[model samples]
Target: MFSYCADPSVLDGWWWFSCFLTSATHLDFYRAFGAVIALLLVTAPAALAMGMAGAMMLRSQIRPLSMLGRFYVNIVRGVPDIVFFLFVPIALGQGIEYLLHLVNCPDWDQPVRQGNDFLVCRDAKMPPVDAPAWVRNLYAFAMAILAFALVFGAFVANTLHGAMQAVPHAQIETAESYGMTRKQAFRRIVLPQMWLVALPGLSNIWQILIKATPLLFLLGIQDVVYWARELGAQKTSLYSYPHPDWRMWYFSILLVFYLLLTWASERGFSWLTRRLSHGQATAEGERLRRATA
Candidate 1:
């Protein structure tokens, strides 16, 4: 952006570097980092909500609902998450478009799936063919978020279910002995204590989630990985800012980004665990009690 940068031929060393970093695409690359952060922030809560629903289903008195919940956790756990990450978005996207096609073009439709090709009317296409670039980006982002939520939600469900079971049955029993209903006991006694038990597993899952964000590139979102590849590609001398293959450097930066993310998350979770464990019946609480005594 400096006057020296006006003639890129004369620019060298740090001057060239400064001008290159100020390019529009480079600015986009910097902004794309926020997309990854946004995905994590949005996906974590969405996954937690889905997991809570799944946990509730697992605990349902209705046999069918419980079986469905257990099946979701078990069957998904069997498949590799990367497989789901790849397949879920394409399938869900086409499924949504297909449904829309059937709704909007009932009279004119040919079969949507003829052999391998998935065909839908133009109007039914997600964001339509005419939609703005940002709309298309938003659509891809939504699909990625859905995929992340579904996969992590299953893991969260399993963790929460186990945590619920680990909560002392005697606590619930005592509540019942005091004339509390099953729901009342769960609300007043079981739920509060289960969180301390769940915290460690949930913290581990959050780290996994942090690492999994790079997969957004595969889902067609313009996330940090996409930007890294774009910016790090070898550039010819004909280009305003020429560089050799810089992917290694770009990815090293990404590694540092994720390292910082996980480290911060770990420190925060550790503090939370300490806070939660301070006055409870868990080992941490016992250790504190002994130390204080």
Candidate 2:
């Protein structure tokens, strides 16, 4: 960024170092860190909502809904996560395109599958061929988010399902005796209590989700891992800011980044657990009560 950086080859020591660190590529790398954080912020809540819905479906009194929920949890959890990471985006994207093609290209008579090619009318293209790079990136990012939500949602579903069941039957029966309907009892009583049980599992899932952020690279999102590898590679004499193989250093930074994330996540969850446990009957809750007294 410095004026002296105009000729990086002639520069030395701190001047060269500062220039290299502030290079355009390095700036993009720095921004990728924020991208990772953004993905986590967006995906976590979306996944939770999907999970809660799946869990509720599993617990539905309607037999069909309960069966659908069980099928969802079983099918998703049964498959490897990496497989889902690879499959969901393509599947979801094609599914969306297929629907759009049907709606937009109703008159096109050609088969969508010609040999290995999946064809759709020009109007059926997701962002259109003339769309900007950022639009394409955004579409890919949206797909990645959906994939993450579906996979992690299953884990959340299983966790919440168990947590819902862990709530004492007597409490629900007591609520029922007071003339509260099943839905009312669940909303007012069972739901709040279940968090105490679900939090630990959800915390573990959160950690997994953190680790899984790197997989965004596989989804073509140009995430932190992508930037790290790209920026850390050895540069030739032809390049303005040439450097040796600094990948080890770049990866080390990523390692520290994730460590800090997990550490911060642990602290946050601990505080949440304490808050959720307040005035409850569990050991932690009782301890909190006594401490307050």
Candidate 3:
């Protein structure tokens, strides 16, 4: 923020633009980029771990565990993603509050949900109403992260399950012939091959996850999209900094940001694929070997 921004009325041309870009709201917009990145950084691994667990469950000998895995994976397949995103945070929030209410407000007279409102005791409110701004933001962000994880985890589960299945029986048998136990062979033989096979699907999931970051706006976090819409709208003379509608400009920057993000992600995945393929006996490995030779 600049001193020139104090009198937004007299500001004009490039000087006005400099102060405009440096304004408080624009600073928030800049920081929102970090929020999106943080969400991705946290959500990606969480989803992968959940997916791995779900995949193993899908393969479990125990009927109930397998059934649970089936439900986990199929829920994403059955429900539209946007619908799932909308539902998860609200459901999880209510569920948490409900548990809290039971513990903290058992003696309270009114129903927890009265008509259209969810009325939890002050102590039971998630983060409590009086908590600082950052705490509330962090809680909402955490909820969004979990919501994204649940949806993407299901897709990743299916991908991993198929990849594990695609590991040849011959490899497992050979590992057993070498006096390895089933678990040992699974770790030493099956797991490595599974990742090699799974890379393509996982790569796709990462791309989709990137595109899905915009949905953070819907989850109540002031994400990049939310900031863009707010800052890009026409500012009337009544506002400190008056400007014409610049949403197109704002969105164009977002477009560039996403394009670059996707480009970088694809390059990273391609490199990882090559790294995974280098020593393997797969066709891609052979191709790499021939190219190197």
State the C-alpha lDDT per candidate. 0.89, 0.93, 0.92
lDDT of 1 by residue, 107-202 (tens): 864888889888888888987899999888888889889999999999999899989999988888999999999999999998888999999999
Looking at model 2, residue 189 earns an lDDT score of 89
> What is the per-residue lDDT of model 3 for residues 1-293, given as tens digits with 9 covering 90 to 100?
77767887777799888988988889999999988888899999999999999999999999999999999899787978999999999999999998999999889999877899999898899989899999998999899999999999999999999999999999899999999998899899999889989999999999999999999998878989999999999998644578789999999999999999999999999999999999789999999999999
Order candidates by TM-score, high to low.
2, 3, 1
Error of model 1, residue 224, in angstroms: 1.8
Best by TM-score: 2
Judged by whole-model lDDT over C-alpha atoms, candidate 3 comes out at: 0.92
Against the hidden true structure, what lDDT does model 2 obtain? 0.93
TM-score for candidate 1, residues paired by index:
0.94
Best-to-worst lDDT order = 2, 3, 1
Model 2 residue 2 CA deviation (Å) reads 3.1
TM-score of 2: 0.97
Candidate 3 positional error at 102, Å:
1.2
